[model samples]
Target: MKIIGFKINNYKSIGSTENFLSVEPKVTALIGKNESGKSNILEAVGKLSFDRPLSSSYLNNKNRGASGEVSIIVHLEYYQSELNEFEISQANTSISFTDNRVVKIEGGLSELLNDDELLMEAIQCVLEMNIRSVWGNDSNRIKSVQDYLNGLKAITSQVYINHSARLGNLKNWITNDYTSKEDLIEKLEIIDNCLTKYYSLLPSVYYREQYPQLEASYKYDDIKNIFKEPNHIFNRFLLAAGITEQEIVEAFEDPIDGNRKTVRNRIARKIQKNIEAEFNEFYNQEKIEFQVEFESRVFKIYILTDDKAMNLSERSNGLRWYISIFVDVLSREYKNKSLVYLLDEPGVYLHVNAQKQLLELFLRLAERDNQVIYTTHSPYMIDSRDITNVRAIEKVEGGNTKVFKSAYNQNLSNDSKMETLSPLVQAIGADLKFNIGPSTSNNNLITEGITDYMYMNAMINYLAIDSALNIIPSAGVSNINRIVSILIGWGCEFKILLDYDKAGYNEYDVLVNKLDETLEDKILFVSCNEEVVKEKMWSNPQTIESLISKDDFKKLSTPYDGSSSSKKLAAKEFHDKVVNKEIQLENETVSNFQTLFEAIEIQKHNIAIVRD
Candidate 1:
């Protein structure tokens, strides 16, 4: 299941964080400056998959109920078994599931309280727990506690291995303690004590060194087995890169059989070759190549150099930092068969060109059906056209995280990037290009499809006295509003002639409001009454061609069927409706050259003279 979007409330400095994610492009970059809470977003997503403690200390007052309460809504996008759209929103500390189809465990801390009474009861129960089991003999109270424990366990069981930070510690504990004759708690306590003693001197360390094997039990051995499983190429690469080559070879030499060693060797060789080819290609393209082979067996990595990839250790920092995170990322990639990557500031160390390469790599990964969640501060990392997908993340009142998105247009031309984006301090954030107009043009008109624009233009010219107007066809109704705003911003007067229908009216009203209230003057809306057009103009085959050929008033007023009444009726209606709407002088604050009503009245008088 790929997470498409999520929001976190009452979690750390984030009182509320709501934003959508790009799931189609497997690699999503969660980019922001240091302390912009980019890492917090990753933490929030991780919490969705696991019941890890959300850091709530940053909330104004930790004493408040909000401190311990974390509300996270994770949208998972997956193909259903039937291959249909399957999306579920899982929310924490909320009333009822965002998706009702998903069930909630009873007596859970984050209860799916469908009613107010249940929520109140759950709150009351929470209060009672702090008072200590005063009535030790209370069987109902004991049962409640037991139920709560069971529910909590159920939640934990669904969590994945990426939740834990201390990998090494878990691995050491598993290797030393398993198979010993001791109770589970005793064994755990012994392992914890060892970790505590070792961490006393160097306290930052957490996680087991060995991969944690997760299954029906939370035992260290259980996780270790999965981590040690040679099938995972990522884990094997991690092991090969971390351990001495001789040691890795020795581990699989005798009892383990040559097959496992052969596979491990092949995997390592493949990784080495891929890295080498990528690096060489960097140089062959006239880009620089940066490489660092750590003398120790702990880690080894290569860096590609280019104009964008300047600064080896100082600017880009060593590849080790990224490599360090890669172990976790790669492991999680395999552990969760369908995993979404959350990479924050991945190419900070790489040059601009290298960053570009990384983005291309991510695009390829996306094609492979892997969801990548990546963030970048570099514009080079982002596709200029997919600007709507870009979300501006900022700090709002009460230290909450606020997200702003482009509602009008999804694809942004490179030239319009700065204007499209509000340029917030940081934003963690694609679409089709409808070729309505040349990208180079500052002034553009977008309408609803080619046919709509064609008919609209025909109507305009037929009623026109004289005007410098450009008519453009659009992909659909949705595109008209966006194009109008852009044209208006560039000091162009535009009129949208759409069918008098629901979808057309909705777009018309929306654009009127967004563009500017006074746009009614410069921007015109002309709608053709479909029924009238069908009965009058479309009924006679020769009539349309006659109207087309006879551009002058005298010929136009002359009836095709030699009937004066039909000609007069068509002239009167066309003058009253279509011509009148285009030149209405409602918003006098802005001038559309001449009043449409006045123009239509003039045309009517002329037609009268022609008929007489």
Candidate 2:
């Protein structure tokens, strides 16, 4: 199951005007500046969880003043097969076998019985038939019905079942004036069980924030009691370790009962193995070993690092935070269940790289039948390649928050919102600028931006020309001179490739005048006939994209409706075709690129000869 999208109304800064935010199935990043209601969006989505509901305090202050009711709707997509399977399982199981199903049925029946006498009669007759079929004799019918009804009543008072009604509050219908006929009531219980199971198969939503610190001095009794709650797999494992009541009593009396000690050690080893496995999935560091010890009449957890033992509390804040969260999540018995995770500012305390690891962890978790929506101002957390996954939350003039599909969309002109998008922009910009990886190669080629880098790098690799030469993109035409200067200062042998535009020529002139004459040999431009450019071009400024034939240009830009940005994007597509060997280059285009490549190689050879 997945959450496709959601809408929020009268929730804090999220007014009714711009409340809808479409969520991606895998990872949806909520990008916004502080106070832009990013957290509010997460909170509103969280209220859709069965465990969480819209509260009075959650109402927007502005809406409260206007006496408007707060509303939130979450759109979900679920697999029909899973729902069918759940229904089948519920149908096969009895109410006494599953307390959760019983409670939901009771609650559902109670609400349903408020009206609809005809429906009630129909349900009663079905129940009577079911009871008669299951318990053949009338003598056994009363005891059986009383036992099933008692079980339902007991669970209804104690447990809060998370299933919603399937057939218009049928559980409420059953609860309302349940027939005294034992057989009929038993049959009704079966129907309620099926309804509850059907509801459980639906996609569930869960809200997670930073975990709180657990008490340090918790003894075996405390751990044992808490572990029995069935919250997570770790707790379940501990409970399954068979820590009997007699064992607890023996531990208090002797503090070293052999059987009790063996169980504790076995549980500790199991937990350590699981934690290490989870940790290594996201982090590659020293192999972490855990030791569970009973000291000072308390259960203590410690980590073994470099053959030295350290208490979990003694670890760094980041490590502790990771462990706490991992353990907390591992403790959840429903981890494998399909869930929509709404994470608000996750990994705020971790370093940038660790936060990146956390992002990887989110992806890994999402791959396991889950969708994760998180809010982050950090660029490391954003997947720049898939900008479509980003939703920009911006504060409007009236203090209402609006969400934009993409931060880079030209439609969003708000200066503050743009500022909020800075991290993402900078991240992508940095990637474009430093196309070369760390290496000792002296041959470096600097281009304008990603498109230029992509085109040239593809050509270089296709031609197998000087594989050692690093291709670096300056991010923009204007940054070329400054980047060249830095490369020169680093004593690197480099060549600059710029477009054939007026600005490109101007920057070339400025750099030649600014740098020493000795370095002037390194500067170059894309060679295209000025007469041909003037005759064939539709625009004044000629870029490297102008090198393509007019027919090919038309083919590329036709899909984009001839817009400049679209043309630029189309140019990228054209480059991809060339790189993939899909397009046969014209003789003139091949000659032009060959001339450029030769010029770059000649410059490198000349520089090397001069140094030798």
Candidate 3:
């Protein structure tokens, strides 16, 4: 079974999620700021029991159900061969359920309820539970089922109204002729155990802030026995590190009749060499060597450094944490076709460079058919080589988690796409290039977004205005700070143009007094809102498009008849015409743009005086 997606509802701060929150088959990087419910998301996914977690505290405080219900849905894909094998196993196993306990099931049941074959297959699971009850408490096999069916038919409204069909089906399944007990059990087992058996194939989820500690040394006698216990801390770590029980056992054996200790030493050396080879593939701070030695019947680990061997305790906390995650990550790699890793703010103790190395490890694991969904505020952890797989969780109204993924919507406003990229705080959050345009310009005009770039660039060329300002498209008004940071980092001088609306007016204060007071004169507000907007019959003009007349706006609207179209695409089309000088415009539109350019020159002169 493979996890394809999950949906959550009424879980803590999460009121409800997307209809289906699709998960990437390989690594998924979920980015958001602190207290944005990023960690809560990972916690929900990591604690996904083979069934599901039940915690009253997990339910939302408000707008929750009377039962304080929390709903979680995990969608899985099962191979035909695996499903066949699971059905075969369930039929041969014996089970009993005569305690009269109510049975409950949840998640992804609508499909089964809709399909007749699937509904019958699911009904068999309930049927098999009743038939298996005959073996409970050594009761008479036939009478136990008969009494159960009789009781199911009598004295119970639930069984009669709900299960009269179950009684009718019982008559068809249980024949009058006596049969061997094994034969009856075999007949009952043919019903299918898709739900239970699917759970068996699922990989167990393990979530932790600190990895289980590995002992420095262990007695060879105890090590052999302890290795048999899969859940033993030491055994788990060793297994995750690719150590095998058979290898450990063989290490202590004298197969050729040589000294036992000498034979053990030879095999131990090979194991140590393999550990070093695997560990070093992702860590490059230094060339590390592992030394596993057996002396006086005790096995001890030593870390080799600079030609000196040191005890494992002598290593840095960062290195120790890395080793713990490395082994645990690779533990299931060889056994399962795919794995889900929910790492919550991984590499907290590691420095920037060390965190970079840790991210490399995650990428390497993802390549081996594992999916890593980790939460992080750090940009270094995000693999931005592709932005489509990234998802952002932001706290919205009523403190609920809202995912900003409308960036992919074809007709969404530029603001929607910008909101999705906000959580990717740095230049690397989206498919943005930080070092390209800014480096080529000495003095720059950073607009609120690409909308300004497309329209303004076309107008400047159309008016034949001589200008040296390099117009750059920012992420959006909300991301002005990040744009400022990028420009400051590149040692570039720039001015920002803000719209005359709420977000823009408030951003000036946020940028100057709050972010950096030095930018007081570097910020400029739109001049068209007063002169052009009030004079025109158009309801309101907040952008450069407002400077264009209605006839021109309709001209760029493309098809001249479509009610909805991508504004960005339309802007590009207008820009192409203006650049080719194949289009003519109204005198008012030309005058409006000229007035805005003249105002910019005056603003630049005013800022220059203050600087001097």
Top lDDT hit: 2
Q: What is the lDDT of residue 324 in candidate 2?
A: 60
lDDT of each: 0.39, 0.57, 0.57
Q: What ranges in model 3 sit over 4 Å off?
A: 1-4, 17-22, 51-68, 76-204, 213-215, 218-233, 241-259, 262-274, 305-307, 396-399, 406-423, 427-474, 477-485, 492-612
lDDT for model 3: 0.57
Q: Which lDDT tens digits does candidate 2 get at residues 330-364?
A: 45434446777788887777766677778777777
User: If scored against the real structure, what TM-score would every candidate get?
Assistant: 0.40, 0.60, 0.55
Lowest summed lDDT window (length 10), candidate 1: 423-432
Q: Pick the candidate with the highest TM-score.
A: 2
Ranking by TM-score: 2, 3, 1
After superposing candidate 1, which stretches have Cα over 4 Å from the reference? 16-39, 51-68, 80-270, 273-332, 405-612
Model 3 residue 333 lDDT score: 66
Model 1, 1-612: lDDT tens digits are: 344455556555556334433333244444334455556666555434322323333223221324444555544433332123212233322211222122232221122222224333433443333212221345665554444434323331222122123222222333232343133224334433432321121101012223222111122233245465664433544452343344444434435567655655554565455444443443243544433332222223344555454323343332433333433433343332444555666666665555555666556545534566655566556643232234444444455554433212223333433333322111111111222222333222344543333333435444453433344544357766665656555455445545344555556567666656664443333322223233333233222113222222333333234473354333333333333353221222011212332322224332211111
Q: After superposition, how far is residue 295 of candidate 2 from its true place, in Å?
A: 1.4
Candidate 2 CA-lDDT value:
0.57
